[model samples]
Target: MLCGGTSAARPATDETQQIADKVKPQIEEKEGKTFDVFNAVEFKTQVVAGTNYFIKVHVGNDEYVHLRVFQSLPHENKPLSLHSYQSSKTKHDQLTFF
Candidate 1:
């Protein structure tokens, strides 16, 4: 892929779930609602100075949310942070950079 461009969307893996779990609380707090079913289903990634994870999460029923979680360069010793999110989405929605 072109440098600094987003990668193609792909099925979420264990690592993806782990990343999503780390940022779930932040998302829930902002939305003012907790998600009982927080499962990462699909994702895309953009490599910046660090990496930005664009994830499609299944939050039970027909509800989905797109999350942008940023991970700083390992040596920086920074924790993953929830950069942004889009709620009230569906399973069919494309997981893209936001």
Candidate 2:
């Protein structure tokens, strides 16, 4: 297995001390709308020099992905090692969030 490296450059940057308002829901939007998601392998970490406030959710697979999703959210009670993954057929079809 090949390990990946990291640097201080991420496309959706929030490096500086700043906060923005969330206008709408991420998964749902009106007509003629689209949202960008990072469907990549080396996407596990988006490290800043010295910070623990950063948050990333890798909801889907990284290697040989049937699906991939990466997003930055404010810190939640959810653990960082914790992820949402289910490979079986029945659970995947029934699972839905709102």
Candidate 3:
């Protein structure tokens, strides 16, 4: 039973790495033009109705870009939905989605 449980967990880790690998370049390309340094700081996963993964990237020293993957139906081959935004110090009247 323990061995089965360990085997089951491997795929989830691999999937998360795959998602990160795919998304990192896109974010780097976009943010690279603006920030001098771009690096991934952390990755967080949330499983609610579906699996959601968040990648936290640091742009320069202060600014940050958040990359989110929303999988409405987990384990589907269809492209996972992606949402990303750069953090701002100034307050905005309205929220923006990208």
- Model 2 lDDT-worst window of ten: 16-25
TM-score between model 3 and native: 0.45
Deviation of model 1 at 36, angstroms: 0.6
**Which stretches of candidate 2 lie above 4 Å from their native place?**
1-70, 73-82, 90-92
Q: lDDT tens digits, residues 1-98, model 3?
A: 23212111211345565675566666667656645554555555566556666655555656666667666664565666665655542221122223
TM-score of each: 0.97, 0.17, 0.45
The candidate scoring highest on lDDT is 1
Ranking by lDDT: 1, 3, 2
Which 10 consecutive residues of model 1 have the lowest summed lDDT? 89-98
Q: How close to the true structure is residue 73 of candidate 3, measured as C-alpha lDDT? A: 69
Error of 1 at 28 (Å): 0.7
CA RMSD per model (angstroms): 0.6, 14.1, 9.4
Tens-digit lDDT string for candidate 2 (3-62): 323333233344221211131122223213332432222222333332222223222343
Candidate 1, lDDT over the whole model: 0.94
Model 1: lDDT of residue 81: 99
1 or 2, which is superior by TM-score?
1
